[model samples]
Target chain A: MSSNKQNEIALAAVKLFEQKGYRATSVQDIADAVGLQKGSLYHYIASKEDLLMQIAHQAILQFNEQLEEILAKEDTARGKLEQMIRTHLIMSIDNLETTTVLWREAFSLGEGPQEVIQGMTDKYLNLVADILRSGTETGEFNVTHPRITALAILGACNWVYRWYHPSGTLTAEEIADIFSKLFLDGLLAH
Target chain B: MSSNKQNEIALAAVKLFEQKGYRATSVQDIADAVGLQKGSLYHYIASKEDLLMQIAHQAILQFNEQLEEILAKEDTARGKLEQMIRTHLIMSIDNLETTTVLWREAFSLGEGPQEVIQGMTDKYLNLVADILRSGTETGEFNVTHPRITALAILGACNWVYRWYHPSGTLTAEEIADIFSKLFLDGLLAH
Candidate 1:
């Protein structure tokens, strides 16, 4: 199969998986969406799990690249963390469907694939924790559990996909700005 | 059906729903888990959606009671928001299985049930927004979008079920304390 055909199948899989869910969306559904028979589709992709793995890998590739670049900087921990949040929000907004599929169906993947996806997630987690720790070292952040706090921040970002509307009042940039400020300054008026 | 039997079915339904998901879980699975035949299970509940509606109502009842009490108090907006965070964390921790089901599967519910759940969620959101608004009015908080900020905080709490472990070092109380403080003091150390 040409790389273009593979990309076509993968995009269809992401849309079907997001709409009907992972279990409910069969290989046939993906094949139909791509205007091919199931047999022909199999020639382009290995299996349903393989489709999911492909989509997941595509999403993770972007995530790893952005985070890797962000971490390479010698900026303060707070600066790195702010950039991390900004990157995360941008990625989630740009790839809303892919992000939804990865967040919702990644857990249902087979152990090997689950571990692969999880390994990517853990890298993000650890990067956040590292920033929190540096903040403590530099007296920029005070926290009892750097790890849990990191999880909370990521959670807030992931949960946005559930309610974010494209035509909503707040643009993605505005939403990201509000999130960073709310998280950084909190709700304190004084 | 007796209330005890209904509760038993609801409990079994929640567990099965969490493990197999709402769409994948069959009525037979829930019945078998509750030690009843499928025919007998229908006598106790209207449908699978009914089972979910029951569970959601239970969760919402507790949520409303706590938020109502907290909102009625003359406490500062910051204090009320903290209490809301604490109650939310405690509820999510104590009702882990139910919370997981509610967060993950509640959207699959029928229009009537979905509206019901959304109504309760909106109440919580409005209450949080009100607190944030009060903070602004009293010169106690700074926010560009109080409603969005409220959603972010709740998202953080709701997403906890994905990663929170019972064996984790931080107990629910400690986690609540840390969360309340983190949202208030933020990551900045200065």
Candidate 2:
């Protein structure tokens, strides 16, 4: 019951942070959304920053876990990258609010939480770079700079959150396929 | 003289908004940054939102102007796209604070200003799509969805603001070259 309540509170916070910017949201507002008295809300979380940290931590962990699963696959680098792009698109769409809060409000976190989030972000980037490096070594890919290539791929994937709509013509999977093709194959007709 | 004051105030606001965020920044802070009395600041701008509007408008207009210049160039689609990427990277790095402010705070504007910014954003996207469409028509590019491909390219370029630093090993020109190559030739060994 305790963990369930905490989960409820976190969900409410994510919604509020998405609708109202994090700085504009108050602890009282979060408590009201979660059906708790302002004072009682403290029992579940230490502070507003704590809630922000919780949301960011949860979001990044999900991304890390998904990437790790893709990394452990025995596929070639191109295959793994496609899978990563698809998983990332699906995850971003599935957890749009969480992703928004993490990207928009994580910087508002205090030093310790910010560092933790940054570390996780770097880990994700490094993992992608590792794949690119391995692909180059095995002659599966022609990437010259694995880190920059990783950033470009991730940037293209991450920007989906900004423009994706449920009512849009293409579904997440279709969009992922288009993106995978664009990244894997050059824009040239050849 | 009055326009100069406004320019100073706008630049100061961009810095403050980048450092402290839009909502966290106060008129007093902006006035202080520009060495003006709080009341005197109103002579140049109407409100904090006005300053945000100014910053966003300036940033988008700059982007549009740069893009327009590239669009007018008498080059192939590949050449235009490469120039676009290079110009975008340099412009983004040059105006990092303005770029950051525009992306981070444009949503906070009222309906009218929000719509205006959105329109400008669409205009930029459409211009990019035009290049891709032309490329595909000429058999120079293999893009299926010009709009989506344009978004991917812009996303990769815009994300430079997040990780770019003067002290970094790679210059903006070098990053732009890598991006252009990656987009044009892709990751596969031809």
Candidate 3:
């Protein structure tokens, strides 16, 4: 089978995993989705778990790249954080199924794949933490715990996947702006 | 079966759902966990999804009562928001298995149960939005979209279930305090 066929199978698997919980989705289900027989499906992928890991790896690569690109810019820590939020918002809206699959089925993957996904998650998480640390060092922020603060920011961003509507009134950019202000400046005025 | 027996089974189901994904956890497994045979388990719950729905209802009921209690206070919007955050943190930490199960397995529940859970989720979500709206009406906030702002705060709080550890250095209260400050006042300082 071609590599393109593998990607096709993986995307179909993601959709199935998102709809039916990962544990309930079978290889045959995936095979049918990709127009392949049960035995032939293994020619392109090792197993269902392997495909899930691939999805996690591919999704995290995009997130890692987005964070790295933003971090490389010569901007304030707050600015970098805002850019990161925007990137996450765009990814969540544009890549809804993959994002949903990543978060929803993350725990179902085995230890090896879970660790790989964890590594990617930690990299993205630490990038956010680093920005907060920079803010504290530069007197740009006064957060008591940079790690907690970073997690909160990412949490708010990730939670968007649960409720964001593609045809909704707010664009991803608009929602990103709302989140950045809420995290950096807060809801209350002085 | 008594109501207490039903509660025991629900808690066991939550634990199983958190450890094993909902679809992977069999009704027999839940019964085994609760020291009941498969046939006896049905006396207490209609089905596995029924038990999952009960957990969701029970968890959301706690959240609803907490929000209402906080809202009933003579506190400011900031205060009410803080109380809400604190309540969430405590619940996430103290009820780790249940919280994790509720979030991780929310999609696995059937439509009728899903709707019930969503109704509870919406009630809690709207309470946060009300706090933000109060702030705006009182001229103490500047959010253009209180609904979005509320979701961000909730997203942060609910996401805590994914990473919180009881033995971690930070107590639930400390984390709640950090979140409260981070949400109410933000990271930037005068």
Candidate 4:
């Protein structure tokens, strides 16, 4: 299969898996949804698990790239933290399908897939933890446990994919600013 | 069937549903898991939707009761806000199973059940919004958009069930206190 055809299969698979769930969704379901025969799907992807694993890999890659870009920028710990939060929020909103797949499919992935996703998730999570540590050192952030706080913060941002509607009232930038302000400066006017 | 028996059925159903998900889980699955024959399962509930609806109602009812108790407390907006945050977090953590079902099984509830869940959700959401609004009015808190701020804040708290393990380090009270501080006072130190 062509690369574009493979992407089309993966994209359709992600949407269906997200909508109907991974176990409930069948290859025929994906193939029918994509206007391809069930056998034709095999030409593009090895199996259903392969399709999900690929989508998950793509999601991790996208998140890693986003994180790397933010960290590479010339900025203080505070700036980097805010940028990380903002970029995560925007990417989640923009890539709702992939974001949903990443979260919703975690339990479905077997040991091999779980390890890959878990590694990516830990890397992403630790990146936040490092920033929190730096903030604490710099006297910019105050929290009891940097590791747990980072998870809570990222959990807050990542779960937005479940409810965030692109056409909803709040824009992506608005959410980013609010979250950054909430996470960093908080609700106080001081 | 007796109310006790019905609740037994629902309880068993919740376990099955949570394990295999609502879509993949059937009345038969619940029956077999509970050691009831397939035909005997319907003696308590009308359909799978009915089973899910009851679970949703039970979950939301507890939350509403919790909110009512918090609202009844005589305190300033700041105190109420803090109490609300604590109560919400404790409630989410305490009722992990039902709460998880409340989120994951919403899609399986169909339209009528979805509306019911949505109404309960909106009421709970608006309760937070009201606290934020009162806080802003009394100058106890400062935020640009109280409604969206409420969403972001609640989103952060509500998704805790996805990751929090009771056997883990932080107690529910500690988690609530940490969340309140992170959201209200933020990460910035004086």
lDDT of 4 by residue, A79-127 (tens): 9988888889898999898888787765577789879988888898888
lDDT of 2 by residue, A1-190 (tens): 4999999999999999988889889999999999999999999998999999999999999999999999887999889988999999899988888888887778888889999999999899999999889888988889999999899988887777677778889888988888888888979999
Instruction: Specify the poorest-scoring 10-residue window by lDDT in model 1 chain A.
Output: A181-190
Chain A TM-scores, candidates in order: 0.96, 0.97, 0.96, 0.95
Better model by DockQ, 1 or 2? Answer: 2
For candidate 3, the clash count comes to 0
Order of candidate numbers by DockQ, starting with the best: 3, 2, 1, 4
Error of 1 at A159 (Å): 1.1
Q: Per-residue lDDT of B12-129 in model 2, one digit per residue for the tens?
A: 9999999888988999999999999999998889899998998999899999999999988799999999999999899999889999888777878999998999899889999999
In DockQ, how does model 1 score against the reference complex?
0.72
Cα error, residue B95 of model 3, in Å, equals 0.7
Per-candidate interface DockQ score: 0.72, 0.82, 0.87, 0.63
Q: Is candidate 2 or candidate 3 better by lDDT?
A: 2
- The best candidate by DockQ is 3
Give each model's whole-structure lDDT. 0.85, 0.89, 0.87, 0.82
CAPRI classification of candidate 1:
medium
TM-score for chain B of each model, two decimals: 0.95, 0.97, 0.95, 0.95
- The lowest-lDDT stretch of 10 consecutive residues in candidate 3 chain A is A181-190
List, residue by residue over A22-118, the lDDT tens digit for candidate 3. Answer: 7889999999998999999999999888888888788988999989999888999888888899989899889888998888898888898898888
